[model samples]
Target: MNLLKSLLIVVIGILPFVVNAQSNNYKVRKCFGYQRDSCTTSANIFYKLNEDSRSALFVKGQSSQTIVSIYNGRDYRISLCWDHILGNRMGFKILDRETKNVLYDNSTDEFATDFEFTVTQSRDIIVELSIPGESTLSKSEGNEELIIIRKDKEMGCVGVLIEHMITPTKGF
Candidate 1:
């Protein structure tokens, strides 16, 4: 009976690991859609990332992107680039939303993932990206593009391309 009891305990411990391992089957990746002239293109990169993963801003020569947004149909994080910082410091202000809290703030431009915060649900958050002396705001009451994401192995995003504008003063 003692041997049987030990066997059951071992199985219980292994069960959790096994279950957690199953979650790895779903491949997590990021899709970046940028405009090439008047037409847009999408660049998909596959990796194992969680909802808490930092949104990819600039991957080497991809500095064309000014903002990085991520949402797993629920939790989300918004990141801005270094060029958007004003007065030598990036601005990250938490909006009055129904959920979410500020977690990381690299507004000083000392880190890669700048202005990282969590959200219980994805909502329109006011983000002001600009340079030291320039003022560039993406806020609008018109037609704004929405980004939606999901886990892999089940067909994730459907035409999720990002958009950006060229700030004359904001340099790479």
Candidate 2:
């Protein structure tokens, strides 16, 4: 009986950690492919969705990059979407992977969330995305309790939608 009681106590002690881990996994699963359908709908008729289109959990003030191949003779549209908690004006840029040149920067276009352009030459490009705001756990905040609460509330989903279609040939 004493052994059983000890086992029960141990299980009770470990329950919270198990539950917390499950909840974290659930949050990530909920964000996965979040914008796949909604973002692609805008390009459905003219463009086919590229496999590289994806969504991920993001926190304010975080930045990430993904590389994608752009084929020559194709027109592509790139769109960005996020949970409103992350706010608007998220930064988006396209850089040439080999030359590292900034091919395009949304900042100059009033932080446009979507861009469409034709690829003249096949190449790999880096798409960089940045969420707006200061880090959620900034040391300046100092309040541990507030930091914990803010971290949960500030996390959100960010999606990049890439669509492509053959560049239409000029008039015959």
Candidate 3:
């Protein structure tokens, strides 16, 4: 009877840890491939997906970046997709990796989420994504010491879909 009780105690003690671990894993797995699988299907008809396309969990006011090689003789399209909680006008920028010159900024184009351009020269470039909003903390009941946690502050998936194809020859 005592051994059974001890085993019961052990199971109870381990239960919370196992549950917490699974929840965390679920959060991560949930975000994986979110953008590519859900958002980019329409584009697949025209452009082949580049291997660097990816998705990740993002919080408001967070920024993330990735580098990819843009080869000459190809036309490329970059599209951004995110959970509505992350807002509609997320910022996206493409910069020359070595020179740090801004090649493209979505803000200039009315914050358009999709961009298409033909590469004239092969180069490595940086693709930067930014989510807009304040941090998760907020004042509660006009008290600075008290905090109000918001469910909307939860992380959401952001996807950068990169697709490309050979630039078609022009003029017969």
Candidate 4:
């Protein structure tokens, strides 16, 4: 009985470590073919939206803020994708890092899945990703509910894909 109890305790202690190892391995798998890519069908659609840009991945419920340089007179397509298990709850926002002015907010825009815009000036912009709390958000400042989704202790992956739009030249 004593030996059986000891073995059971040992297995239970090591179970978490084993599970964590498997999850870590899954995260680093070549399933996406790249670190910034996604393996889901929905994500594949976004990947085809633009060819000049690549995608970046993050864990669900965790916020990611990135500073990117936007060139003047250039159009960019920014898309967001989650594990698909999380549904359409994933959203992102673009803000002028210096002025804190919101360049784009998906939540207010009917939970838009993507955005396309042309910048007039070259500047550093902040891209933020979050799991929205409310099903719908209105255009009111300081009254939005910012909720994080905790689907599981080991949350799945989310991706942000940015593609630069090619402008047609005047040459004929």
lDDT of each: 0.33, 0.82, 0.81, 0.60
lDDT of 1 at 117: 34
Task: Tell me the tens digit of each residue's lDDT in model 1 across 1-172.
Answer: 9999999999998998886454244354432321111122212232222322222222111112122344423323233333221123333443323343443334545633333233444454433322232211222223555623222222211121233222124367
The residue-level lDDT of candidate 1 at 73 comes to 38
List of clashing residue pairs for candidate 2: none
TM-score against truth, every candidate: 0.25, 0.75, 0.74, 0.57
Clashes of each: 0, 0, 0, 0
Give a tens-digit lDDT track for model 4, residues 139-171.
224565684434343255565667664443457
Candidate 4: list runs displaced more than 4 Å: 1-60, 133-154, 169-172
- Candidate 1 global lDDT: 0.33
* Most accurate candidate by TM-score: 2
User: Which ranking of candidates, highest TM-score first?
Assistant: 2, 3, 4, 1
| Two-way TM-score contest, 3 vs 4, winner | 3
Per-residue error (Å), model 2, residue 83: 0.5
Candidate 3: tens digits of C-alpha lDDT, residues 1-172:
9999999999999999986444246456766776666565443476888898888878777788899999999999988888877787899999999999999999999999889999999999999998898555421234557544444455677888888998989999
Worst lDDT window (10 residues) for model 2?
135-144
| Candidate of highest lDDT | 2
Full ranking by lDDT: 2, 3, 4, 1
Could you tell me the TM-score of candidate 4?
A: 0.57
